[model samples]
Target: MRMMVAGLAMMPADAQDIEPDGPDIVVTAGKPLRVDAKLLRAAQRRFAEDRPAHAPRATLRFELWRGYSRISATDVGLALTDGAGGQLPVTIDGDGRVVFATLPAGRWFLTAPAQSQGMHLRPIVLSSGTSVEDRRLGDLRAQCRVMVAMAKADASLLAMPLIGMFDAIGGCASKRFGFYHPVEHPLASATATGAGVMRTLRLSVTSTSYEAPLSDRNLPNDARVRLAYR
Candidate 1:
């Protein structure tokens, strides 16, 4: 949205020295949101008492969706990994939401299954004394290739290790790519594509083209690559 980085300060420059670039990148701001303060305080207490062994405590509410409709994702198994060798299991509630009460106050990688598709959520940050309540992460319907492409284009999207591994493994037998407008920023899609030498990948909304390489060091030189999207 406004591209607000947590706990970061803004730089100041003289207005006379500034000049316009070719075109300004526009970022749309989302609705203002806040978390439950009481819950956050309790979590901070738990984190302080637990010390090095335990992660901070906080609650997560994942609103599951299918296209534009809200759907129940109860019992869906979610894998949580915090890069620092921490792992946990998170399950959705009967109301299609995930209520995770305790987690570290840092970015995390979330992998889950939605219907017949795989969902990946990365850089899910949980502040030490805050809960993720009103804001929504990226959509679960997005395909791995689309997500991977976004990660490739944006370093912030690379928070998911598995997605990085997918890019590294190379020989892609098949791939599914789909783009969705992030809930937090409805004005734009997660990524934009461009043309290159290899295969062609199109993003419907952006109409941007990008090359899809077929060869990988780990795979045979003649290995075929396939891509799909829903």
Candidate 2:
């Protein structure tokens, strides 16, 4: 999509200059219809526009935790939005994770209202008609890995107090990694430091993936999201 906002100037350059060299091969007869560059560009533009039939169906999963424990049946609400904020249908289990199976193909926005203390979101893409049990189990497993990693980080901080503090506060302020302080105010510096470390660990554990949904929604074939706390 065109990346423009107030006061942002588009860079002027020759198309050829911006293009990169890639492998070239000649097309022969007896092959699938070859798409021209212009046609491809048009298709891309259509997808970006969030046109109907370009929306992909997806299943999302949510995993909640309190110190490495999975909490089930927490309230979850999810909706997909196009890049421009158009809503798409989305489904989630009581735990709040969306199944990849149910969504149509297209760009989607998945959101979960903050539930309980320390709830994390893990959004996944599934092809349409994916078996319910398979995706459910898969979501659980993915969340478990994240929980294990968070637990590991928590363990590391217990041994070195000063280093942990520096790692939490100093490291976050510098923006060295995706780490950040969690709470707006820390009752004590140590508490804040620990919270920051926890945030870093959470960010590190979650990731997003794009795959064809089982049912054809006629939307974009892929989706993207990161594990989000907000």
Candidate 3:
């Protein structure tokens, strides 16, 4: 099967990246805050209605940095290792965010691939009604970029719209670029250039499999890309 990869390149020139809007505040350890039972029950009902069934949810936000500039870190691979030695792979969304909707309450160690920098790798404890947001992952040089593929038949119809969608949500400029794949003969990869300051990037794709290589790492042999149909 011939698949056409659509590269979404976000240059630093066109759009400015966004930063956290407010000051960073630390939550200090203190006496347990009390909540009224009526309010707690109402809130629980609302949360259950909005979230997946029977799973505790949490949010993690990542910020990428290159020296003094903040860049978008999208398409980066994240994994949560639980106490039982099981690992759950999660993808950072276009907004440099990941939501854990089905993770059970426990201790988890969050980590990125070896090629990633500026991420938190420490153990985090999660419980019901708790979430971690706007946590600084650390500073990382620009390494990973975004790439996607579609059936060659749908390339023309889907290309521009996909690019625009990425730009609108990721807050980066989208363009086409070239990349070479070893076994695939020719692979398309997008490279962003010209130093446009961007704060976040969002890349979305409907595919059975996708892989983002760590910086300075070769593409893996088992990378698979299959179109996902609804």
Best by TM-score: 1
- Per-residue lDDT of candidate 3, residues 40-131 (tens digit): 12223334442332123422233433222233445545566665777777555554554444453455544445445432111121223422
| Backbone collisions counted per model | 5, 35, 11
TM-scores, one per candidate: 0.26, 0.24, 0.24
Model 2: per-residue Cα lDDT over 5-114, one tens digit each: 11111111212122111111112333321212222222233233432332334332333333233345334444555567676555446444443344435544444344
How high is the lDDT of residue 185 in model 1?
17
**lDDT by residue for model 1 (130-194), tens:** 23222111111111222233333333553455445543543122232122122221121122122
Q: Point out the higher-scoring one by TM-score: 1 or 2.
A: 1
- Indicate the TM-score of model 3: 0.24
Candidate 2 ranges with C-alpha deviation above 4 Å: 1-62, 71-74, 94-97, 102-104, 114-118, 122-230
